[model samples]
Target: MANLNPYLSFRTEARQAMEFYQGVLGGDLEITVFSEFPDMVQNPDQSDLVMHAQLTTPDGLVLMASDTPDGMPFEPPQGFSVSLSGNSTQRTQEVWDALADGAAITMPLDTAPWGGTFGMLVDRFGVPWMLQGDSE
Candidate 1:
């Protein structure tokens, strides 16, 4: 089966952002630094930058990210959000609260028109997320 995962790019915050996500999402995180790959080492100043980071949550969610090498243009994510839906309402609310730390809430998590809890927020790492609680 094929899988589609969100790939995020950060200027130099990939390591921090991915680590934060691991804490919030409770996952196994594997990271590789730019210095680890000699061929990919473009700037010594950014040698510690995360060349690749992947977090796989126990719920089967996978997120991947990398830092933009120095001398390359970096733009924060916009226009799209990483949407999360959970089977358990309690777990869903737990995640929402965790992500709400230092987040800019675009919408308060509350009863939606469709009767499910829904909300939007941009986390401190500048990543946007939409959370939906149990549909039923």
Candidate 2:
């Protein structure tokens, strides 16, 4: 089966952001630093930066993230939000609330005209997200 996961890119705080997510969502996070990969540590300054991090939540949410390499640019663009939708209204609401922490709500989570509960927000990390739940 094809799985949909959100892969995040950070300037230099991938580890911190992933840890924050693990805290909010109750997940186990595995982070590998640039120092772990000899080939990537050619630049000694980047050794402590996060090369990659994966968070696997108890509910099976898989989120991957990485920091931009030493010479790369990380520009956060507008106009794209990771959309999460399902039938579990209560659970979805809980997730929406959690993600809304320190975020600006573009749309309040309410019954949508399309017959579902929907909302949009930009998380603290500047990642946009959309949460949806089936109408009960």
Top-TM-score candidate index: 1
Model 1, range 1-136, lDDT digits (tens) per residue? 9999999999989999999999989989999999998888887888999989999999899999999997889888998999988646677788888899999999988877876788899999999999888766
Best by lDDT: 1
> Could you give candidate 2's per-residue lDDT for residues 8-89 as a string of tens digits?
8988879888987887678899999988888877578778888889999887989999988767767884767777787477
Supply the global lDDT for candidate 1: 0.90
* Pairs in clash, predicted candidate 2: none
Residue-level error in angstroms, candidate 1, position 71 = 1.5
Worst 10 residues of 1 by lDDT: 85-94
- Clashing residue pairs in candidate 1 (N, C-alpha, C atoms within 3 angstroms): none
What's each prediction's clash count?
Answer: 0, 0
Q: Over all chains combined, what TM-score does candidate 2 have?
A: 0.85
